[model samples]
Target: MSISRRNFAIGLSALTLTACNSTLGTTSNSGAPKPKGLPADLRPHLNRDYAAWVASFRNRALSQGITESTLNAAFRDTGYLPGVIKRDRNQTEFTRTLEDYLSIAASDERISKGRAAFTRHRSTLEKLEQSYGVDAEIICAIWGLESYYGDRKGDIPVISATSTLAFDGRRGSFYEKQLIAALKILQNGDITPSRMTGSWAGAMGHTQFIPTSYQSFAVDYTGDGRRDIWSDDPSDALASTAAYLKRSGWTRGTKWGRELAAGETASRVLQPQAGGPRFAVTGNFNAIKRYNNSDSYAIGVGHLSDRIAGAGPLRTPFPPDKYGLTKDDRIALQSRLTSNGYDTGGADGVLGPKSRAAIADYQRSLGLDPSGDPSQQLLQTLS
Candidate 1:
């Protein structure tokens, strides 16, 4: 969920622009094979062999009642965009500390803007929650995080991005299906190709809905007969996110989570292997994770929502070791531990039990007290 792999826009505007710097083959008029010598990370499915992929996708779209003309317009001149693949590949690979992720995604400026949005759209938001059983703060938080309240709905052409990823072998089937789904959106006369721009991975709207998520969850809250998530109307986007959560098993009238006084010196109560956190996180928290798999992402959205709703910060420190650590730094430490034979499971920055065990093993190896506190000294040692 962290944008460390990307350079996003910063400011308070109704519209934002973004550009991706990556290596991928573009669609050539002559439809030649992909040029060789490209980095493995940047190489895309070449045009020479892209026909079968395109044909398969075209068939799927046509089966969905999408016409050939719409498909052609969306796919023609589209290229194998490397930036899209890069962003997707990097989405969950690296770990990030809570503080660092919040710094990028849920800053004070974003919170202020979120609060303002909540107030400005109070009537509509209230109606949405009343109908959908979701909170306005959660919606605002999602909006702010996704596109900075509609300021930065990315400009990459979804068709090219999805098409290239489909042709490429990495998660090729998934992206290929998404590419067809996108064409179906166009064929249905839902939105224009020109207006169908989004993240390199095809996430669009104020709350970054992927093509499939949009198809499954997007709604026309304004009764416009079109589910236009790309429009300035935040209602549809907010409602859609709420709907996604609702369908994903969000429990109404319960908090996402509460801060807990996790004990000191590696208490069993604070450890991730304890099975779950002392603080009770409701099912809605899981629903947030459905949007993104990372616990840190769910926590950020939940905590930011609480903040926007005029709630205070956590009652306890998010355990000691997480202090003073940024998202990437935590990931780096986890990576080091993993490489050193400490199996942290993933490089995700959260100091889960596995990471703590790794830390303990590392400390024991170094002849230090194996408390697994994630202390500043331990971090320094790891560095």
Candidate 2:
């Protein structure tokens, strides 16, 4: 649900469309005007089969002790979202090298923003750390990575998104469980249905806790009788993340890990990239991984937290990639390609889809095969 393991690139476009409608009926059932600025696929359309599915699901909701009033409010403006299904089915499965992961995770912009956010909320974060026994820097790092310090908390309605996934049935049982938990959250008066917005997959709030995780770990740190993570004030969400880490067995006073120098040894060492830096990790590293189950993710969080705490970058350099290019070379390639009229989005040292397309375009211009691959030769050619 944290999405750290899936793709580190946050989709800024989706975050811009928060004003889109959430109900199944665009203009009939609620008589609300059709939502503007939303993609057609994301808008709800009439589907009798989906209607029947919801009708049957209501019985199950009732059996689970969800009151009739809660069900009605939760489902009032909710509807099947085709875009959610599309996104679920078409998830891009790819791996990022530890170097690239760290580049994005601790990029100059993220580090700068993180420092400001940490400074702004230092008191709250430190208090949460004090209470939960989790490190404050770690909490800030998760917030930085999860929602860019609350800049991109998703806008899709959770009930609609969860119910659509539940009806789609590909991961029906899993989503059904989420839908039920969401309803329970609604029944608990933590958030209203209209305000219960989150990611397309139902990951919500500052740290993107899925409903089940929220039920288990979320806290009302504000003491307002509501565990409100969706609001601009991130006290509750930050506290919840600390609580989650505490629950996940974060050891107090233990470092997550540190990069090992040449000839350095430790009780447990991890070299995610074979020829890159080796890390001496602790139980706290595993605790970070419990938030997102990936070695790269754990390293990203640890390294970013360290950076936020004023540490320098890794001392050792990573070997050239399979394409025989280094991070600097990749960044140069992207910068050159963009200057040549083919945009690679930004020179982030990551050859993602836009970068690859730019490379392919440059290759075609040279009467070469458009393989969209990067190489030392290609970098030289661009130079």
What are the per-residue Cα lDDT tens digits for candidate 2 across 1-383?
44332132234212221222232224523555543444666666567788899999999999999999999989886677788888787765566788988887788888998999999999999988789899999999988878778887777788888898899999789889889999999999999987798777888888888898899988999999999999899999999999889988998888898999999999999999989999999999888888877788788888889899999989999999998888999999999899889988889898878899999999999999999999888888877
- Relative to the true structure, how large is the alpha-carbon lDDT of every model? 0.67, 0.82
* Candidate 1: segments with Cα more than 4 A from true spot: 1-47, 51-60, 86-92, 261-278, 318-383
Per-model TM against the reference: 0.68, 0.92
Candidate 1 is scored at a TM of 0.68
Clashing pairs in 2: 23-77
**lDDT per residue as tens, model 1, 1-383:** 43211122112111121111222333345474443433443433345566666777677778877787997777655655555556555554344445445444555677788898889888888887888887777877878777778877766667877787777778677776677778878877779876787766667778877787788898889888888888887888888888888887887777677656555232222222122234456677777777766566667787788889998655543433326564566778888888778888677565666788898999999998998767656667766
